[model samples]
Target chain A: MRDLSLHIIDIVQNSVRADASLVNLTIEISGEVLIIRIGDNGCGMTAETLQKVTDPFYTTRTTRKVGLGLPFFKQSAEQSGGELIIESEVGVGTVVTATLGLHHLDRPPMGDLSETVSLVMSGNPQVDIVFTCKDDKNEFTLVTTEVKEILGDLDISMPKVTRFLREMIEENLIELKLKIE
Target chain B: MTKVKSLDDLKKMREQLQSQVSLRVNSETPEKMVQVKVSMATCGIASGAKEIMNLFVNELDRRAIDAVITQTGCMGYCFAEPTIEVTIPGKEPVVFGYVNAQKANEIIEQYVVAGNLVDGIIPANYETVKDQKNK
Candidate 1:
C-alpha cells in the first residue's frame, strides 16, 4: 500500500469479504505513535489460520494464490518501529491493530482517508461502518447509521449523500489537523 | 451521535419504500448511471491506481454526477497500469490508459461532464461477449 489509508482500506475489505455486518475503523495519533485499529463482527478465523494470516503465501480465497494484505501491513508497521497484533475467535470476530512511529522515515503518509471511507461505504451500503479519528487535539466519530436516519428513504450510497458524508469527514479531519499543527 | 432505531426496522422501511419506487431502481441501473471501473490489481496499484480511484470517487461526487465507481482486477493491460473503463448511459464503455491526476481531471470535465471526448482513449483490443456469441 502507498499509504496507511490504503492499508486500512485493504484490511476493511477483508472484513467485508468475511461477511461482516459491522466494521469499526479507528485511527489515533499520540505523542509519537500513530495507531490504526480495525475490528469486525464476522466469521473469525481459527488459531491456525490466524497464526498464518501474516504469511503472504496463505490465503482462503480461491481466486488468488497469495494474500499480501496483512503481511504487507505487518511489514510496514515493523519497518516504522511499530507493532501489529491480531486477535480472533473462531465464532466471534477479529480485531487487527497496528502502531507506527509517527515521524519514522519509513512510515508512509496517511493518505486520503475520507475518500477511502467513502468508497467502502458506497460499496457496501448494507454493512454498518463506524469511523473514528483521534489526535492529541481533538476526536470525532462518524457513523453511517446516523446518516441513514437523517436520510429516511434515500439510500446512503446516493451520490449526493455520499458526497455529503465525504465532505463532512474531510472537513472534520482538516479541523483536527489544523489544531494538531 | 444520536442513537438510531433498530437496523432491521430501517431495512424493512427501505424495502417498503423501494418497492413503491421500483421505477427509480430501474433508472439507477448501469445502463443509465455512469459506470467507472478502476483497475486495482497488484500491477495497477504499483502504478498508482489507488490514488486515481480516490480521485474518481471524490471528483465525481463533488460534481454531483450520478456514477457507480468500482475497482476490478487486472484487465491484462499492465502497460496501461491504472487503467479506467468509463461507460456513460447507453454508451459503450471506453477504456483510458496511463491516467494520471491531470488526465483523470480532464476525463471528468471533458468526457464525463461535457460529453466531449478527451485524449488517452485505449481502443478495444478484444471483441465483446455479445459479438463473439453473434459470430
Candidate 2:
C-alpha cells in the first residue's frame, strides 16, 4: 500500500492464494502516466465476490477476514487521478489494472520493487511470473525461471541475491530515465 | 570518483571505516550487536513486511541496541511472511516468519538479547544447495 510495488505484491498474494500458477505483471510509464497491469491464471472470482472485494470489510479467507487491500489499491489509483479496473472469469483467470498520474502528489511513492521481485521469485518458485517494465525509451523483461536458473540452489535469502535484484531494478530505471533525458 | 579495485581497497574506504570506527568508539555499546535482515521480497511485502521492518528498525534504534539492520529478498516460505533472519554473531542465523511489531519486540528482547529461540521458525530441513551439498 505504500507504493505501487507493494500494491502489486498484495494483489499477487491474493492470486497465489487463489491457486494461481502464472502471474504476469506489466508496468508502462509514458510521459507523466504510469500504468500497472497484473494478470493471473488463478481461480477467478465470482460476481458476488468481486462486488464485495472493494468493500474493505469482506474477505473470503477465514484468516482475519476484514480485507482492506483491494479497496486501498482502488483509492490509491483514484487519488492519483487514475483508475483501477478488475476483470475476472470464474474458473478462467483474473486481471487487475491501475493507471496513475505519475506527477500527481496524491499518488503513493514507488516502494522497494527489487525486494518485491526477488521475494516473489524466491517464495513461489513453482509459480512463474513475467515482469515487464517499459517507458518511452527502453523496456526490460524479467522472468522468474531465468533468475532461478542463474541462482541454482543458492539461497535467495542471501544479501548477494538482494543486491542483484536491487542492481537490476536501479540500473533499468536509470537506463530508461537516461533515454528520456 | 575513484573506483575500488579490490576488497582491500574497500576496507580502506572513508565511509566504511568511519562508520565502523565511530561505532567502536561510541560508548554505551550494547553487550551484543544483533544483525537483523528483513526479507522484503514480494511475498514478504504482501504480508506486511515493510511495517514489520520499520517497526524493528525504529524499536532497535530507540532502545539503542547496537544492531545493524538490513533487508534481504525472499526466504522461500511465501505462506509465512514477512520473514526475518537474525544473526547474533557466534550464533546460527535464525529465520522467523509472519513477523509483526509485537513479535519483533519479543525477538529483540528474548532471542536477540537473551539468546532464546521464539516460535514461528520454518523447519531447518528446508536447505539451500550449500547445506545440501555439505550434508
| Over 4 Å off, model 2 | A155-159, A178-181, B1-48, B51-115, B118-135
Clashing pairs in 1: none
RMSD (Å) per prediction: 6.9, 11.0
Residue B88 alpha-carbon offset, candidate 2, angstroms:
14
Give model 1 RMSD, 1 decimal.
6.9
Q: Per-residue alpha-carbon lDDT of model 2 for A96-175, expressed as tens digits?
A: 99999988989888776655665555445567788788887778777766655554433333333433454565566565
Query: Candidate 1 residues A6-115, lDDT tens each?
Result: 78777877787677899999888888998899999999999999999999999875444677889989998999999999999977889999999988989888877777
Question: Per-residue lDDT tens digits of candidate 2, residues B19-78?
Answer: 543575353232245667777544577678866765665566466455645556555566
Q: Of the candidates shown, which would achieve the greatest TM-score relative to the real structure?
A: 1
Report every candidate's CA lDDT.
0.76, 0.68
**Which ranges of candidate 1 are over 4 A from the true structure?**
A158-160, A177-181, B1-31, B37-46, B58-64, B70-135
Q: Model 1, B1-135: lDDT tens per residue?
A: 533333454455556545533454455354567878777655566688778877887787677576777666556566777899999887889999899999999999999989999889888865433446567
* 10 residues in a row with least lDDT, candidate 2 chain B: B2-11
TM-score of every candidate relative to the true structure: 0.71, 0.62
- The top-ranked prediction according to DockQ is 1
